[model samples]
Target chain A: MEVEGMPPARLREPAHRVSPRAVRYWTVNALLGNVLAWAVMFVIAWFLPEGRWWSTTLVWLFVVAMLANVVEVVVEPVVRYRRTRWEVRDGRVFVQTGWLSRDQRIAPLSRVQTVDTHRGAVMRLYRLANITVTTASAAGPITIPCLDTDLAEAVTAELARITGQTRGDAT
Target chain B: MLLLTPVRTLGSFAVPLVLAVLGVRRGRDEDPWWLLVVVAGAALAVVFGVVSWAVTRYRFTDEQVQLRSGVLSRRVTTAPLDRVRSVDIEAPPLHRVLGLAKVKVGTGVDATRLELDGVSAAQATDLRTYLLARSRVAGGDGEGAPAPVDAPGRGGTSYLGPAQPETELARIDWGWLRYAPFSLSSLVVVAGVFGVLAQFGDELPIDQIDVAQDAWRWVVAQALLALVGAVVLVVVVGWVVVSTVTYVLTWWNLRVVREGRGNLRITRGLLTTHSQTVERAKVRGALMGEPFLLRLVRGAELSAIATGVGTGGRTRVLPPAPRSVVVQVGHELLEEHGPLTMAMVGHGPRARRRIHVRHQWGTLLVTGALAVPTYLLQDLWVLGRLPDWGPPGLLVVLGLVNALVAESAWRNLGHGLTDRHLVVQTGTFMRTREVLERAGIIGWRIEQGFFQRRLGLADLMATTAAGSEVLTAPDIPLDLAVQLAGRATPGMLDDFLV
Candidate 1:
């Protein structure tokens, strides 16, 4: 099928890439949260009766979580950043990104209910913003995580324009 | 000012009042002040009702309907008349007895904007009719393009207007009563029976009688062969009586009529009267649903995929009827040639294989999960509770049943695209054949899971702003799925593909 040649590269690269600094911001924030949680678990483990089933379980959990957090915070963010892509044109918005399974969603601007951007403190520090486009579909919002603030604004403006152009008929 | 404010207020407190009275009667011997307590509660209720009545206010403007209420934290809401998609009125037995009804105004955006709890029945009807007429005018001008005012009496034109003469489209026929026992509505009746028993259970000496224990003894006393037959008989008899009663209550006096140019008005219910008006313009297509049991009687349910109804998928344009009746209604509603009653395009052998694998695996996965617990707790552990060989025998029976179901589902799976519309049919227990207009489709989604990809299968979904939102044709070949997506809305796949 002609579609065979249409996927993978263009699907992920046609849209503006999210800020590269997103990986560092996400990893640092995730590591901090994991350390804080581990501290609480350590305190609980100190009070637990020595050599009990729960104590051993907690010790194993702490070790496994520490490793998992390192991989999740350090590795996953970089992979996700590379995979994420979004574009808005004409009467449609396209997003292609997923952790394991490649989920490509094309939401018509006519179905879009809201378009908003968010910048958390960490993201703000990294000069990055996230744009979320919500359609009336029950599949939930289509989000473009960690883009340059100016690009996010441009995307939002373009979306608004498309939404206006495609308005009236569907409703 | 609403005339039924007092009645509406009383309706709010009726449930609590009944419970309070029941509690007082039950505690009469224990507490001498029980009657006094009930009287005091009633007095407080009256005071609250009066306060609420004084605060509540509602009015209609040229473009919007405004409502205000609440004693301390006042909330004022305005709903644009044009945005209003449906105006539904319902009256429970209590409201019917008092000649009052509840009015719910919905704008497809929000679930329900305004609900006037108590209004005189005649007032409810008048309000509904007025709102519907106004809504039709608003919707026609809503798109900023003047809707073409086609001449009425044209065979194919769907329009809404004040001058359009009212004509009865369909009404409830008791001849379809035979199909009631085969409907899922019977399950609702069974649930209602349980609900009634649970509500009055404490006063009924149910615990003292130990019905469960008695039933167990009876089952033990009966021969195994006799037990199966008796159980089947009881279940079938109970199902028939319950379903018949439920069907009557839900569909009693049901009627559908074309009142205005593009408005279809439906009035139904026995114990709880329901009146709903849906704009014909918003109707994208019709879906004919036939559950496993209903299939035996050749009865099908017809529901409209219309916008602004806020019903999601429960938008029934016609009740369960024979295949011919449902098809006729479908044709009349869409004003197109029998889209709902089409000869479907069947899938290839590969599609059948994919469906069989999909259905069989789903059933086996569930059965395997159940069997694992039975093996661990009963067989391996020798709990002696389950009869020997019972669990394994049940597993075998389930496997056979699942195979038949998978085969049935595979046989039913098909999709066809015509010049004006697309028809997709699938399902095992709940067979649904949806017919959607080609133009109503707004977008497309193509999905292929791990197993599906391996099987060279893809699920294609046609997304529309209205109706079910997404109509999917599952387990079709990847190439065909792509073709269907392209055909659903031309050039939609081109941008994404390149």
Candidate 2:
């Protein structure tokens, strides 16, 4: 086992990984959007539907969704920060994520065949973009969604550096 | 030249049109209930046919070929003649009867699958002959002598033209296939026939079986005898037929002319023939397809990346060749005496085997899972409340198939990465030995998912500078997968983000 700040000798860091701000951005957006959705559904039900009463259908949907939402909310405070943690080691990059189930991914910067950045309208407004580091897996490409635009650029530069030095990267 | 595109469209629509008219005729066969649907369908089909007729048209140029179609969403594709890797003119049974054939020119160009679909046999031949000459002259440097208009077969070869003949130096042994346990068609027939019987629940109607009513008591007894007889009669004869046909069609008048650079000029055919002019630099890598049945028959298909041969990541290499020829021609293609497939076996002995086993699992699992809804609904409704054994049985059979593959993967997985070449030899059938130069490799990548991470596995895929597919090394160890990916050369990973 390796200590903090000291990467394992064999492991190499990817030039960049998903940053904290990007994780926070997606989480907040999803949370706010979900909360607004439930509130709207309740308002419509309470006002309309001609004497709408609590029923099994509503109970089943709302209760299950609400329960799931609560679980997420409870877990977010403890784990949201972790979602953005990225570590660069000597020859590898490691990232740990998930609010409910912890997930960690490590990629050698040399192996990153393609480092790309994508920006959408909403992301552009917030100066945020998604960065995907692609490897030839055949299953699909690996994407790291929602990164600061500047961070994406930095990641690209760092990846290019590794690829140049190591000559690894197949798009 | 008859425009069969229009004829094919008209013929296809005519079937339903006749059906619809019969269903809707007021004076005779009119049925009130089916009238609306029949009329609507016929009308829609006619409209579609007319619209399609107006859209499709193809043009040939000295430098390229263009096929344009679609009306509202007009689509046009142009393949530079220079980019064309191989042109196969296929004449199906019906095509032979009609004196018609289709020319499929593979440019190894893009994902659109851009192809010139319909052309006359004469037209296809003329086009093929012209393209062969051009490619030959264009050769390795790509721009050489002016392409001649007419080039004839040198000797008494059939459609191979005068230029390319299956090489005499190339090796092929048809007689050795007598002992093959895995014959391609046998497996297909056995699997297909047994699967159908299994679906009907092993209860063959006496009429269907010609004579059977007892439980498999006597059946098993006969089966043992039948297995021996079938191996001798059916399997052996069937494999002989397959190898004979393959040799005749692919290697007939077979000649391999060594050209400038490492390119090989190959042309051979039986009745409906094909001619391919390939450049050494253009071939990405070689792949050997070893179907289980083919393994038994000692049959194997040698395929390679003619990167610009066809659209949508297609490789134009060979119609399945006899194991003998595969070994022989493979040597010339790889410019090495050793088996190419064995060279691809993964690092430290078991790497390729591990990768092959793990990767195949994903395909089998996904296919099995995707059929769940069918299993669920069938059991819930018509299949009775009893547990549906179809999906589970299928999974078991799939597992059995994978076991065979595992054996092959285990025995064959050995890759020798030399400075100039990446030689991969990992196949049970026909012993697919392949050799690829490292300089020819353009792109490579490594990837790991959550499940893979948990298992501490990854994949290293390498693509030649010329081909569309990246030769996959699935389930490469995490460290090595990354190392390989990191070391992939630039320009190999074009459009990675895209």
Candidate 3:
């Protein structure tokens, strides 16, 4: 949430972080949608109905949309703070995060189907990447966003090892 | 062909605009309106050319196929050959004239899409052949690549993979015929022709039959007759064109080739071409389908159940086929009742299939509940007489019909386990027959819901090792369902892996 050039101490816990790309990305959707919505409300108020109720309703909507900006700004960071936690336990990756209700997801090396690493422009600047682990349950790839380079690779190798070990038992 | 699309698109757009402009100069009354349209269209032409040049890019490789396009928001999607289920080629009549065709390569990925737009027909066939070969291959098996088939004169030899290639393998495509009355183009032509006929029919030079208050009924009947006649005429003509065109397009190129191991390649196309390949190991479950109408009329279709590899698991391989061919191919292409055959190899209890047959009652009940009301409202309420609760009377009748439907579903149900094949067939209207290979089943589980638990029943779901077809016996007797699950599983991986 801070601008460039802030002290490293200004950096809070890594858990309190959002995908800088996702933040920039979602901001576009929110900003564009708000503008489009407000513009429509404005046009409707100005041309249609032609009464005080219309004008007042337009003013109320503008106030509400303006108020929504505050919430829109704070929502992701608040979410970032509450749910973000990544820990490695016994060579397996466990991610615990959810806004309304927490969900603890564990990906053991043995069950890991494939490991995918992805990065976007914003993460490039921050020297960060996201690692995704898929499994057999038809669940989406569990993405651990903003991992250190060495850590992600280590996790990938570890997961493969675990998957191999478990597969060995079945064999 | 790569150089032709932009030229062709430009030609199509430019020709009309130029013609309109020329016409505007030559003609007097239409000048002003035509000039505006020509100017606007010319501007459109420039935009299309720029976008086409900037965005178009595609690549095909041994490992994967990639496509990238879009002007404002570009997208790049790649499908790995290792995960590919099939590569389909389509040719519209326009493609026949152009000598180019479209290919859709599917890897069970979320971003699966059409790739290699408008490759030459021969190149499209070659690409399909290569991908199908790739699907049969295990990673890094370079020895048995494409040589066996390419060396056609060496017919006595066989390709390497899993199952033996049977000389009498069956593959029948009735799609060319199915498209006759059911084609989208045919439907559109019928609608358009009917609209034209209806408009022209009213002005037909027919003598007036009557001039009275009650004559309106006769007049309405005549109009209805004309409308019906128009519809039949359109359907007949459109069916003739579509079926004939499809036959010409497909029958000549019809081919079914068996390659090394258990690979089946089916290639057919008229203008825009199509090819389908199914490897034995990848074929999890094979099922036959015929909607009620088709079943009554003796028509059929086929589908494959396979794991949506790399796709996060959300796809089914449905290659439409003829009924008789389905029965023949279902037995040949995959293990008949594979992974579930051990307990029922021959004259075995077949208890699992029988239990599955019993489970059809649930779907029967549900179908009955849904259909009863529709029939009553549409069929019984012809007279607009309201008896306090007018809709309720029909609603009651609808519920009764749904009950009848459920009864039919249960009565018509059939299942069997024979000669190591586990077969579960069920349907009220159109039937579905699933054949499984006991050894191929990867895993099995017995799931219990509160309602099922209360009813002393459970769900038995099993997966094949290849992660394709998932066969389930829902709402079967708990004891039997559990027995089948255990039987189907039976240390499944121990026998297959490592």
Best by lDDT: 1
User: Each candidate's iRMS in angstroms?
Assistant: 4.9, 9.8, 20.4
The digit string of per-residue lDDT tens for model 1 on B1-498 reads 233444555667778877977877786667667667657766766777787878887788777778888999999987787777777899888778888888888776654458877777877876776676567666665444444432212332323332767778789999988888878956876766666655654564334445558786555446445745765676678888878887889899988887646677789999998988776666778899999888988999988777667647347767678888888888777778857766776667777787767656766776666665565555455443556466567667776887788788878888887777889999989999998888777656656676776776767777765676778887777667766666566765566553
Better of 1 and 3 by lDDT: 1
| CAPRI category for model 1 | acceptable
Candidate 2 CAPRI grade: incorrect
TM-score for all predictions? 0.79, 0.59, 0.55
TM-score of every candidate's chain A: 0.81, 0.62, 0.59
Tens digits of per-residue lDDT for model 2, B196-290: 54565445343444354566557765875775575457544555665555545554554455543345555555565554555455665566666
Clashes of each: 5, 68, 31
Error of model 1, residue B147, in angstroms:
12
For candidate 1, give the DockQ. 0.23
Task: Tell me the chain A TM-score of model 2.
Answer: 0.62
Candidate 3 chain B worst ten-residue window by lDDT:
B339-348
Better of 1 and 2 by DockQ: 1
Local distance difference test values of all predictions, in order: 0.73, 0.55, 0.53
Candidate 2 residue-wise lDDT, A84-137, digit = tens: 455445544455445533333445555556678888766676688766665433
